[model samples]
Target: MISSLKRFLIGRPLKSTELGEQRLNKKKALAILSSDALSSVAYGPEQILIVLATVGAAAFWYSLPIALGVLILLIALILSYRQIIFAYPHGGGAYMVSKNNLGITPGLISGGSLLVDYILTVAVSVSAGTDAITSAFPALHAHNVMIAVFFVLFITLLNLRGLTESATILAYPVYLFVVALFILIGVGGYTILTGQVSPELHTPMGTTVTGLSLFLLLRAFASGSSALTGVEAISNAIPNFKEPAPNNAAKTLIAMGSLLGILFSGIILLAYFYGIAPSEEVTVVSQIAEGVFGRNYVYYFIQGTTALILILAANTGYSAFPLLAVNLAKDKFIPRMFTIRGDRLGYSNGIIILGFLSILLIIAFKGRTEQLIPLYAVGVFIPFTLSQTGMMVKWFRERPKGWLPKLLINSTGALISFSVTLIFFLTKFNQVWPVLIFIPIMITLFKKIRKHYDEIAEQLRISTCEEATPIQGNIIIIPIAGITRVVENSLNYAKSLSPQQIIAVHISFDKEEQKKLEEKWGQWQTGVRLVSLHSLHRSIIQPLTKFIDSIERRTTGSNYQVTVLIPEFIPKKGWHHILHNQSSFLIRTVLLHRKNVVVATVPYHLKK
Candidate 1:
């Protein structure tokens, strides 16, 4: 069943060389890698305002300080992770970092945290995009769940087709959005500077300027930190880069960081300058555009393009999450299936799981951005904290002479990143603490499962003692349906074992077949005893097991062993064994349960 499902979902597997054919160039790779980071510009500022709404519009200015804090954290994280790409460019990201430095538990934590973050990256990006689309088209505002689900399905299908396919499709719109955004920001800034702003700039939503407090500032900082959610994608995706992975990865990081920083900062500043209100009814970008180019075709075109980019940005998570899970699975922090690559060499199972979970989140939140934001930064921060801590350990362990400048830089990066992580934790905990607790619990469970697998693997290891155990008092029993070459082969193999006694057991599911089998066995001159067992229940394993137990009771003595020879029958095509025959497997499992009994199969090929 599982095999069929896998074949249906991913099709036949491809070889590594075929997989290599799907390798993405740096340009395509960057487009895929930067999707999540670029998507942030669409809604990162809106998230800040959503949080600041409680404190009023005056608190919206807090986005500046918040954006600054996030920027500092982003720069530090990028620099610290550049060293990671240099050190371990094979691309395990947080999992490799934590495993190499902080041990398995920390590795699981980082892995689980990153997994959750990836799922949320998809959910949040899609939800935010859907919300923006709804804002533009009020009809969609009422059907948010349907809209979000459709987008999730679209993204899932695109990714399943392959990363390069999805990247090629998304590249132009994202690039167009970036250019349109720059143009809007440039035009808006010029309009504001020349004091040619629209009348709506002075229309306030009853927001009064109030003195800022530490709590409010921290809240703003936490909200604005959404921009940093996608910064780690480059690290997670380093392996997908072309030859010279570290150089490509470092270059990708720098490009993503610089572009994201400029776009994010520009959007926030433009919104603030144009007196854009933070309201659930209106997005800041739309408001700023309206203020700058009120109801103009160019403004609507840019808005539409921005909405498309936001939707496409979720593609970044679609590209990265599966690869991240594959990395974790390789390190034994996730299930083995996650490590299995598709025809495209992407972690297809992980991608499907991510898509399913993101869809669930989108459904649960009813595609509301406001509802999902609370859970957004929690998972990302956990990995940020652990990754920074791991880097600190990496720095200390590899202490190099005359590398003071590098050491100091890493140390400062660690300090700033760690500090921001703490602030994010404290500020977002009330809303996101549940996810923090949930992630650790999952990591603990994963470790326990890994330990169990290791123990089972140890027990299954082959030893010479097992192969050298001498056969003593061998009694052979052959299970038969009727007279055929399949049965004859089993009888011959039983004789070859040179058993002290040989018995052929026939299960009577049908009286006529049993009578014919009995008559045939009576005529056979193979010198084998015949025993018939009645199975009123019409089950094979239970009746065969009872006969074996009866034989064992008759010969209870030291060094006595029972060898059961089972005839193999092909029901139809050869692969039909999987589709139709399960009784043979069940009998083998039941027989193996006894210490003295060993089951063997004699195969009879069916003519094609």
Candidate 2:
């Protein structure tokens, strides 16, 4: 029933040979990979406005300059990542770039930061999408947490269904959002230019509370930098593209960057001219839509698409996180389980884990986008800086054709990225310190995990110089509940091993039952020793394990080996197994860890 349900939801499992067919073309790839970056325009400009709004309505005018700073950084990242796509076409993104050019430490730091950013992408994007919904219908504001969590679950299920399938399902909303925003910006710009509506310099909302300073401007820039969060995803996911992967991926990155720049700048300009103010209940995009269309159908259309694209933005994290995890796993810095693909050829484990973590963040922050935005950009930009520096080092070391020019671009990007990271750390330290500490903790964990894998390989290594230990004889012990066909079969199987000695033992809680078992064994004329252990506390496993431990202690380091053969009767139906006591399973689970003991299960299937 479970398998049938799974097949129904995710569809039938595709063959491994079908993996090639699953790779996406540029159009579809843009929607899947660029959604996170594209969706940020819904709230990215508002983040800057939000930070600047603390001083007064007049400070909201600073949002334009701050957005242009973010846009400059975005251009640098796009250029740097395009180089990354060409250089490391196999696609580990920032993790691979930093690890290969720098050292393992930097690599892990980049990887850890990307991991954190991906998780935040899901949380922040969904929370923002929920905010858009509540903005549309004020009555739904109370249930935002539930709405955000449901979106997470829905997106996670779509990803698990398969990559190409998810791209197909999620691509439409992205294009629709882009078109809708273009219309909003076009209409809003026309009104201002044609004098249909006069531009307001002051928002006429909040009073003057504080003064504007350099630190405040830097803080606003740091907040707006969240717009660039998903830009690295394209570089990380080059492998997901069709043949000629690098060129196609680079083109997609350019297209995505172009769209992002246009939309982000357009929104910021409109917000400035229209005198938009950040609202707690309604999003900045919703306000812009209303200003242009005045709560008409087009207004709701923009709101709906904005919410949709934001919700779908989580797909960027969904696509990139697993790919990065796979690279880490291949390097032995993480568990190998992440390297395994699901039935749909997606990294199901990593996808599910991302979903779970994002849901937790949503619940913890009460699905508030403003609360979660502080922790967003730092994780992404740390990798941005590291990746750019890594590439710069590569250019200096390799000195390929035109390496000097490439180095200059990357060096500038690295400088800008480093500055943004520092500003985010200093300005949002209270909210973001946990992530600063988390990256180091993650790096330490990566080292420990790598060390453990190395130790395991060394221990499991077989050397030609080592001598093999020979077994002198085998002493087989049959654990029994009563005189039954299953016990008889287990004894027969044990006898086939040509053991030096055989003993049948039973845990007898009642004296009368013990005597009856002995009498029955005597009547059967079996030459095996029948020792009955009496448990005062009525604990069967304790006495049974004690008996095995005593035997192991008596023959420590000897050539002889002890084998405990557990007899279990298999139930015909899956659910019927729960009806019986699982003593054999419990006994086997405890004894399997003994050094000198070999545990075996002898199953007798029930015809019923």
Candidate 3:
């Protein structure tokens, strides 16, 4: 029944041969894998306005320029990764690329960074998704953390249902979100082009800081680059695409990049022209929608779709992180458990771990999108820089037909991403440091795991000393407390194991009890040797432990096996065991530690 329920929830387990059925085409892949980049438009422009707002409304003039700069970086990343798709078609994300070209240490670092980035993608996306709803209805503000966590769990369960199923489930939201935004831009654009622009769009005031400095502009650009976080995912999970994987992945990458660029630039300019600023009660996009459509049905539609798409965007991490974990496990940098697919052929361990880590982040950050925003951009950029840097090295070494352009393009991406990473560290040091520190610790853990696996592999290899030899015979010792049916059953089973020698032993605290057991054994004529040991301490486990230890000493270098048969009666009801003491458990625990000892339990259930 339990297995049936699992099947019902996650679908029937797939055969390893069915992996091809799970491979997605470009359209579904775009919706499944590109949701992260697509959903970032909901917050990327707002992040710019948020940082710019620190300098007050006057400094908001730089929002367009900062967003445009991020747009350029996004394009460079897409172009660079397109070359990556063809060069390393077998799903070479930053970790694999860096490992192939740079070295093991850089590869480990890139893996750690990308893992953190994927976790943060889930956390940040879900939190921002919850924020979209809260912005639409302030009454739900208090439940934001709960809402965000629920979204993560829901997406996790969806992915566990299998890739194609989840892609189908979540694909509609991406289209709805895109359609809603286009409608918003169209209606809002009409407002601006016509004389119907709200007069407030042209007015400005509220200068918190006196001057607009390069530091503040750089800070704004750093924040806006959050949009670039999900670009590498397509590269990371390129293998999930159908045949002609490289071209499909490249086309999808270009399309996602182009769409995000359009949406981000359009939204930034719209928000800029519409006089929308970061609000404690509403999102920047929410404000823009309302400012254009007023408090009407279209406004609610935009808000609802935004919330759905933002929440579903976390599906991007679900779809990609598992594949990354599987690859890492194959490299032996993590536990082998991740290599096994679940009922739906998803990497259940990785998806579940990502969900839990994201839950912690949501709870720790109180589910506020702005609170998590500062820490969100750095983890992703590390991989971006490393991936491009490695790709440039690949171009130079491989010297493919178009190596020069690809190398220059990747070099440009590497420099910009590295610069952004540095600038972000300076701007958001307090938040960035935790991730930076955590990354090295993760790399160290990976190295330790790899080292342990290597040692274990060498040890488990064919060796003469530990080679198997058939068991010559068995000496069974039955710890008989008193003559009972359970003991009778244990002795009968022991005779089958080896009728040559079976000893029924009793640890008695009183001579009277020992004498009674000896007489009873004589009457039963069980053909089992009766051995009695006096226990002044009245402890059952200690004396039994000593007997096993003495046997181990006698058999020092021999293959003679010593089996300790512990007779235990099964109670009619489970709770009846609480009424009866668990001495057999104690005896087995004590005997298990002895050399050449096999502890076995024989149970005779009561007919009650």
Candidate 4:
């Protein structure tokens, strides 16, 4: 029933051969991959306002310059990552680039940073999307966290359904958002040209708090850099594109960067002309929409599409994070399960884990975009800087054609990205300190996992075994609670292995029970030896494990393995298993650490 329900929701599981068809075309790729960077315009200008607002109304004039600065940096990063795409086209994300060029430690650090950043991306995007709704409806403000969590879960389910399915479904909202933003820009530009600003927005322009300073300008620039967080995702997910994958991915990057530049600068200008100020009550985009559309249906349409696009923007993180995790797993940094494809051929483990982490951030921050924004760009910028640095190093080593110019470009980008990383640290260290703590923990974990794998490999290394080597003898020890059908089946299966001897060991907590079982075994004449033991403390696993240890110590034969056969009964229904204590589980848990001891479970399914 569970499998049928899962099939119903995500469709039938695709075979491994069906994975090749999951590639996305350019148009659908843009809709799925670029949403995070593109939808960021909804709040990018407002973040600048948040920083500059500290210096009062005069600082508002500098908003355009700060945004332009961010744009210049954006183009530089796009060019740098374009090189990244051409050079390491098999999805040259920070993890791969840094690990390849810099080393494993640097790679894992960048990977950890990106992992944290993507989680924050979902949190911030969902919170910002909820902020849009609350700005319009007002009454929904109290339910922001709940709404953001629901959106995260919704995106997770959509992703698990399959990649192409989610991308196709999300394409419309992205298109709608782009169309809505352009309409706002066009109508707002018309309003400016006509010199007919709304009365509600065009108020007295006076100094209220303080004077503008260079510090405020830099802060605004740093905050506005959030717009570039998801820009590198295109390069990271190059494999997901259709044939001519690298070319398609590069084109998509340029397309996204162009849209981001135009809309971001255009929105800031509209807000400037309309005199939209950053307010605690509503978003700057909300204010601009109202100024242009005048509380009409277009205003609500803009609001609804803005919310939709922002929520769906989490899809960008969902697309890239899992793929990055798969890369990390291949390097043995994270769990191997992340590399395993789900029934739908999607990285469902990473997707579900990302959803849960994003929801935790939602609950922690109460779905406040402002609070989450401080923690946002820090993660991405760390990777951005490292990826560029890795490329810069790569160019000098490989000295590919046009190395000098490409080298200079990546170096410049690295400098700029490094500057932003430092700025994020200085400006919002309190908010972003968690990332600082997280990276080292992940690095330590990676080393430990590597150590364990290395040790296990060494231990399991096989000696030279010629074809003349004879089969080794083995002994089977069966632990049974009674003379039931489950025991009969277990002994019969043990006979198939052709063990030299089969011994049935029963642990009795009561003396009377032990004697009764021994009498019954004698009467049955089962041929298998019945070894009865008394447990004074009523401990089943402890006494049984000791008996196995005594046998291992007494065994004199070489090239022989000691095996313990555990008999288990499977109930007719899933819930019925819970009615019985899981003795087999306890036995294996203790015996797994012992050397040369194998515990095998033999099951007899019960009919109701």
| CA-lDDT, candidates in order | 0.76, 0.91, 0.85, 0.87
Tell me the spans in candidate 2 whose CA falls farther than 4 Å from its real position.
201-210
By lDDT, the candidates rank as 2, 4, 3, 1
Candidate with top lDDT is 2
Clashes of each: 0, 0, 0, 0
Quote the lDDT for 489 in model 3.
Answer: 93
Error of 4 at 406 (Å): 1.6
Candidate 1 per-residue lDDT over residues 143-221, each given as its tens digit: 8888888888888877776666677877787778878888888998898788787645442434455665686667677
Query: How big is the positional error of residue 521 in model 2, measured in Å on the Cα after superposition?
Result: 1.8
Question: What stretches of model 4 exceed 4 Å from their correct place?
Answer: 198-210, 463-472, 556-559
TM-score of each prediction: 0.83, 0.96, 0.91, 0.95
Local error of candidate 2 at residue 221 (angstroms): 0.7
Candidate 4 pairs with clashing backbones: none
Error of 1 at 594 (Å): 6.2
Q: How close is candidate 3 to the true structure, as a TM-score?
A: 0.91
| Model 4 lDDT per residue over 1-608, tens place | 99889988888889999887898999999998999999889888988988877866556767777888898899899999888888878894888889999998999888888888788888889888998999999998888888898999899999999999998899999999999999999999998888787645543444333666666667788899988889989887988888899999989999998999999999998987787889987888889999888899999999999999899989999999999888878877678899889999899999999999999888987787567676778888888999999998999999977899999999999999999888888777778888777788989998898787778878778867734445477778999999999999998898777646788999999988889999999998888898888899989988888888888877755666789989999999999978999988888788888877987889899999
Candidate 4 residue 64 C-alpha distance from true site, Å: 1.2
Q: What is the lDDT of residue 483 in candidate 1?
A: 79
